[model samples]
Target: MSLLFENAIGDFELSTATLYSPTNGDLEATRDEPVPIDGIVEYASYHDRLDHPEKDDWIAVPLHESDSAALTGEYIAFTDHALHGEIFVYDDGDDYESIDRDAFVESTLAERVRFWHSDYAPDDPPSYFDSPIAEREPPRRPLSGDDAASFFDELESFVRAEMDAQRDANGEKAAGSTPEALREQGFGAIPSLSSLGQPEDGTYRFRIDDDGDDRAQDRHRYVQREFGIFEGNEVQLFPPNAERAPDAFPIAATVGSIEGRTVRLAVDWHAIEDRSTVGGYLRQKRRGYAVTLLLNSVPYDRELEAIARVRERDDHRALLTGETAVTFGDTAGVKSSQQDVELNQEQELAVSCALLADHLFCIHGPPGTGKTRTLVEVVRRSVQAGDDVLVCADSNQAVDNLVAGSSTAATADERSLHAYAQHGADEFVLRRVNAGNSSNDVVGERYATCDGRADVVAATNSSAATLDREFDVLVLDEATQATCTASCIPLARANKVVLAGDHKQLPPFSATEDPPESAAGMSLFEHLYADGGVYEGVGVQLRTQYRMHRDIAWFSNRRFYDRALRQGRDVASLADRPALVGYDVGGSEETIDHSKRNDAEARLVAHVVDELRTEAGLEAAEIGVITPYTAQVDAVRTKLTAQLERGREVTVDTIDSFQGSEKVAIVISLVRSNADGEVGFLDRPLDGPRRLNVAMTRAERFCALIGDWYTLRDSRGGAGDGTDLYDDLHSFLESTGRLRRVEPEFIPIPE
Candidate 1:
């Protein structure tokens, strides 16, 4: 059998050692045995067991035959005395096999046997063992670099020769033929430069000139007879302006025959530049010429007609020898000329939107302060500047909110930015930055080109490494919630940056040790807010609470807001917004206590479904559920699935899978574990607080939390606090009405 061995190891070191071919029952003394070593090929001497450990005791050896060696019927075989019994050889029709004490082996050598050891060990064999030798016709040498190159050159010459012979096979004189005759012969059928540029000898040098006033000056010049088709059509000879040199020179021009007109030609300036320029510069510049090629025309009459049409409609004229065109705005329309009206200062997002041009703008407001709304408007204006923008969030829910809110007014070209989340790159210059599945590696790889390549790139602190690339503008949403490492790096990439978030809702995770002064001091928020005056001086603070009901906002102010006020923060100002209203679901602790766990969960799920189905009237797809722990996630998934099976249309997902996702309504299960038997919330190390926040907030139209308030409140206080867990829970229930007990009521799961 003939075999070819190609080395697949790209750059690893190669070695030589004894090789045993189990298939042919042949043993070679060294890697280069019977053949000379070539480039990157070497003889193996020692095996590194540690580096290449075998899963089993068995080891495989391979043998290669020389390409030039011819196979002969004659062969030889030999064996060592390490066998416990007699050895037998047989040709299995498919391949040759050698059996020694029931073990199989095949060899290329003809029959011959020799034994050196008396006893045989079937399980393990000694390292050194000599067997047999096989000889065949001498092998031929493989192709060399020079030989391969020459072969390809000869092949190309032959192909060209054959094509030319076929062209002239009709026994008709084709050289110097008329344009119509060339057209009939399939040489100049098209009135474009492509047809005219066909080379008689497969080679041509041509120049087109459309700038000259006279008919003769408009035509193209060809040094070789191969470009004969472009003889008459001047407009098709060169690009709009032949003298307007490109960054890379030497454009290729093509010739063809036009109906009525004798000849026509076309110039592919973009193609010429693309083929000549190296690397990314060519791709960036290709866009301009691609547009030009799509509009180019051939034939003098057609060219003149097109130019006249453009002139009649607008004050546009062909310049630089028809290779370029210039235009002046002559038409007057007030609406078309009007610039975008900036939003009023009273608008909640006005200040943050205005700071899109600032080198750095940090927005720190309490919860319900309209940070997200401000971010959306700023992103809109940033993208309007023809800049590509990337928007990313630490959580999937954040990404979803940004995408959904921004997609409303996007143009067809702008809508393409949404693909960055799925593809990890954007075709449109602007895209929402997404660290898929919380993997920073994806962000790092894609951000390498985020500078001028992308209009905007947004991601969380975990992906801060991506900010290593430079950017024109940067916006950090939910800034206060991010850790220092996650928030600070992206600032390095942007000439102008915006930071918007509520500091009171959540502060950066405190570091275990004080960081060095030179290290930018912990959190990006702290770095900005270190001096209270700096935070107050930067930008606008929106106090509107549009998300919550007025009553809820008012009540929350007295509870959560008042606490922040005690710390000298301005969180209580949102109570004035008329858009905020509150709803009260009357219930008592005794009523809630009588409800079973399953009944409580089911009632909650049904309430959410009914609200989405009837009250808010939202689609089933626009609702989600978030749980803090995997155990709770599994539990909720089961109960929700059962409810859904019974005809409810709501969908439930875990916090981990729900990142970068959004829904109109969300219900969060803050499963408080009593693993330590404490009355308050357990301070268990849980995964994905950021993920939980992202998921819970993503169902933006409405949100609800269901959990043990007491446990959560107690957990918030460090172990040093003397307060009992139940006391913490009472305080929590009084502060925020996120939890409430419900009376047992059998509600039908929505179908």
Candidate 2:
């Protein structure tokens, strides 16, 4: 083998070597194979394993000045003890295989030194073997003048954080444990060696031995914790026993499909040398053998690949630099195509500019502003003009909304993409790419099975990576909830891009507690409104909102949208009702059992929910209770269940989970009512109370905020904009006769 393409670095005894591959895309474990090296390796100073003496597998191979320069690239080596190697290969020159050379070298230097022994050939046993440092700083974005590194860093942080959070939420697990021990702890395990088939045929099947109590009975029970797992979820298949096969590594695979108690995984055959060896290894004890399955929810592997491809495009830089910015109405000189549906002036302008743009276009959509409908119109025109369009959203629900239009009464007359497709106006291929369990799967098969003949494809941003074909236009929905790095996944596959979202609502869900200005939590939609952002001079704002009453929409319009959002529906009939109301409680907020809660405020919330359902005649489904704390949500949910009539249920959730949902009446419990006047995360000092904005906008007719007025009005007085937002809210409520104060006896607080 050529030295540059060789998999082995140092010559060691084959029987004594242990191959190491990536676990969850990180160097977390070992497996079998000749370690393949595909990138350059940097030489860091080496340490002698004899100094520690406890590390028996590590034998420092002395590097001579004569051959150090020739062994610079990556390699696999073995010497005295069990073999362990790093693998980075240019398997296929596709976007995913474009190795970040700087990232590779940094990892090698930080972990351990890899040197080649010139005295021995690949077949000959050379000097001592090399062992990596026991611990390593998680791999970070390499600032190698790569434009896509920032997005990669941010997205990687989210992916890792989400995985860690999920693991913590699911309860911790031991690294190595017996099958019975794991099963006793509610973890799934497959006992007895049966059969392992190849997934190269698009579907892989496996059967477990059915004999003992440990047999595969209810396979679905094994995966009950992971039933919601989507396509491309990470998985690790562990060997029967870690002590017996210390050198054996877990096989890595991605979920393809799940049926009953059976899970189908797409194994990376290129990484594994032979399938028979894996089968033989599992068949060691036959009936006595057991394999443990670990499913990880890190779903951004393809996103990293998408970043590599987007970084190579010239339009990416142009869009960032504002050279390709296209303003609304710039289409005045361009030919306008007739659409089947009638669009308002702003929607017409948005669609026209999107059609005229050769590179990038952005629409700043406020809450309930029909942005999805406008985007659908843009897609309609693009597909009619013979342009293949790809529509992507951060969530599966958002993608469905974009295709079927937002769930609002005013939009009932609006035609959905599926409805349009039913008309057969054009013989175009429309497809939705989603997981097997998604609501859209019943519509048709995934885009991959369409035989390369799709005119329009809609999918979640992460799912868009499954597409191999390119498109003329890419329309991204719910852009505010998506990080710029995640947006690059679909952005790389299209020639021109159009994004529609409301940045004033809740920002992207982040594991980091940093401010929105920080790179850690910023969203792509927020990036467009930043200094010198693409929206600086050319962006369009959808001003009309159709979801809320005029009185209900006024607060968001004046406080968040700068009075730019106009009410689309007339609300003269709601003048007799209390549209915006606040009930003040005198109780103080306290942190109990690591959760923020106020018994007085929670009781008041239950009271309000009762009034809305019984007195106001609103159905249970038309009412929702929103809070900033999970403890508060649980408290209110419990109180409502105990106090409300039997069979009456109301939705209670945190503000973050209720962003895309709306109700006829919304009751909010600001959980941070305290003597210290702390408003907590509700009033963001830097980001302008985004959670509060979402809470207030969710109501269509009636909105009630229950809190300690003194806590909100007097809290955070010295802080910048955050304190002023609360003060303004208090002022608005008082001036409009919406603020109502109640005595302590009105709602009883539990002792």
Candidate 3:
């Protein structure tokens, strides 16, 4: 006699058997005949791990849960011959067929009752199961051929536009036009170079010389700063007199070392062998020969290569389509915890969904939500399961946050991410791969330089592409701020991808206007959840926030999140603290030189900072002053520094620089209070006003907004001018008694 069990989920095959016994964890099964009625089934001794068994002819059996539970111990006693019939089993609101009762009774009487399970969970049963695989929507189509080319072209064009904008902002142009054009101008036209030292091995050395031109010096500094050539970056080297021949064009070389004004270039042997290339440039002209460094083309070429080869790779296809060969169920034992405090329900669900994802998963994290905490838990569990994981983000600061954990710990005794990571560091290797000089004392002191094999590696998205090995999973934090093509370089190296970001906060930015017909200008994180995208209605959203007070969170919660955001357990409300305080400075906005600044607003902010310091006893380090423009940042920082007591340092920066940061008390300076009601980039169309959302969510206890109410509310910046957001804030603050006009000396919280 043989028993046959049918699975409710159709996609996966029965790979392992599980039996719950009080003494031993493994299942003990002895079968005379194998069955393959519907799905692949296997039965073997608990001690002997067996592969799929051969198909056999077996009669169906019916069994009840109560009857199965009653029979305990090693085996159950049953009659050899009984009535044959199928059992209709309802498992968690789903219906499926079970083995014949007579076959099961005889089989169980001879052998123990067998339970199907996954190989990943041999000790524990699955705590939760996702929706049936058959019910899920088909994976989205992957971009290929002409569509792929067009998408990459638009993405590259957007990058170029941003580069050009930066150059224009700094009042500097590119080095030269093209190879042919540079050759037309004499080799002397290029920047002069001198030999650094004697050649060693395959490395060619040169020193960048000051040609007595200020513009040339500025351009060199720009290249070094923008391209990060001193931080071991690679750039294309074009000798001034390099032959115009096809093979003698610019050659790729690594920035081996940079000291003072000298640089060492590690050129390939092939390029060094050719007399017309780098070797000849270094050997023939030891001094006075000009060389041009092509800094812009490196990223463009790398992105194009990733796009060109993505479709040919299976993992890349999976990343694009959200389909994978393997699937997972939530591990029941994995609990979400930050040291001692357990995670909220929404955060726990996000952790489960991230693990259960087959190919791609998107975690929609609103501001102040415990998305990072949730993601770190997922990383710990993934490493425990012996999967090599890669964590990446658009910025080095975001990556450092993931590695070192939160600086603003919610609880006083809460342990940091480094502590959590160090707990399991002995079990597996953890490495921090940074491309920039960003380092906090927390992460920098401990993991400043970790080499060799690593079970988990944290890096920026740009640096992840340079890794030699692939990862089992890639966790991309702050994914919404990176372009699709920028994400593809790391996306190509992993089989599964998890994206965690807030789409409502900010999308990928382009200095130039987006192409009229290209969706590639948007971030992949937003694209996946938009309208008919693959993970559309399927991604998990963390609804609870632990950082902001309820009053401070109310505007963004209602405006952007549709009131889905709520305060955590101990979060303060209006009754507990002055959460949302507004000061209508009615300041006159003016553009000094070329940058925008408001003198009245700056003075008002300085007064507020002074009051907070004298009355509330809040130090400058505890408070943050944020603005929208660089000139305004300088203005606020200057005024606050001069007005405040000596040795008081207040953190002041633009909105973009403070994306992944928070503070105890925060103030914002809206510098566009002009008569024309021109808000500049504050109210851009299509992209929405995400900068305001980011700015408002940074405060934990108290938040203050100082702006010209008339200019903001009566903006004439066409459709979607974002005036409605300011209107909403005004109404909310007025109704809640949080709005106040700026006085000579004002207090954040009225006594």
Best model per TM-score: 3
Candidate 1 ranges beyond 4 A from true positions: 1-359, 365-373, 376-392, 395-428, 431-454, 457-469, 506-522, 530-535, 561-618, 646-668, 673-751
Ranking by TM-score: 3, 2, 1
Q: What is candidate 3's CA lDDT for residue 434?
A: 56
Predicted candidate 3 versus true structure: per-residue lDDT over 566-644, tens digit per residue:
7775665323348778877776776764678987788888777776677777777888888888888888777776667
Clashes of 1: 64
lDDT of 2 at 46: 22
Q: Could you tell me the TM-score of candidate 3?
A: 0.68
**Cα-based lDDT for every prediction:** 0.36, 0.60, 0.60
Q: What residue runs in model 2 are displaced by over 4 Å at the alpha carbon?
A: 1-298, 321-336, 406-415, 423-428, 439-452, 513-516, 529-535, 572-576, 588-594, 646-648, 686-688, 715-722, 748-751
Summing lDDT over every window of 10 consecutive residues in candidate 1, give the lowest-scoring window.
Answer: 326-335
Could you tell me every candidate's TM-score relative to the true structure? 0.37, 0.64, 0.68
Q: Judge candidate 3 at residue 683 and give its lDDT.
A: 69
lDDT per residue as tens, model 2, 1-751: 1121121224323334332332243332222321222211211112222122333443322222222323322222222222324323222323212223234334432132232311122332223322111011111221234543454455556656655665443333425555567667556544443435444455454444555454445555444442333445654555556566534446655667655555665655565776666645544432333445454443456656776686667667445433333322112112236564556788776776566555566788888787777886788778776788998888877777665543232232244565454323444567778644345432433222354577889888888888899998899988888877678789889987888887777777654444445443566656654333434533578888888878778888988788998878765323346888888778767775467877778788888877776677878888999988888887877788887774137999988889888988889998776656667666665544878888988988888888777777664565422376777888888998988997657785343
Pairs that clash in candidate 2:
9-76, 17-83, 18-83, 30-249, 31-249, 219-261
Instruction: Let me know the TM-score candidate 1 reaches against the reference structure.
Output: 0.37
- Model 1, range 1-751, lDDT digits (tens) per residue? 0001111111122233222223343432322222211110111111122122321321212222222222121221222224534333334556645445223222222111111001111122222321111111111222245643343243233334333443343212222343345445444222222222343333232333223354544434321122233333222222222355344432334444333223333444555545433222222311112100111112222323322332332211111012121111111110011122433343333432233222334565444444555565555555544443445444545544544433432221122234333332333344334444323333334333434455555554345343446555566666654543344345434445566665434344322211112112234444443333222333445555444333333434453344332122222212222221111222112122222123344445556555556556566666676653554544555556666433235666555466434555667655442323232112322222233334433544456655544344445654422234234334544555434454335334432
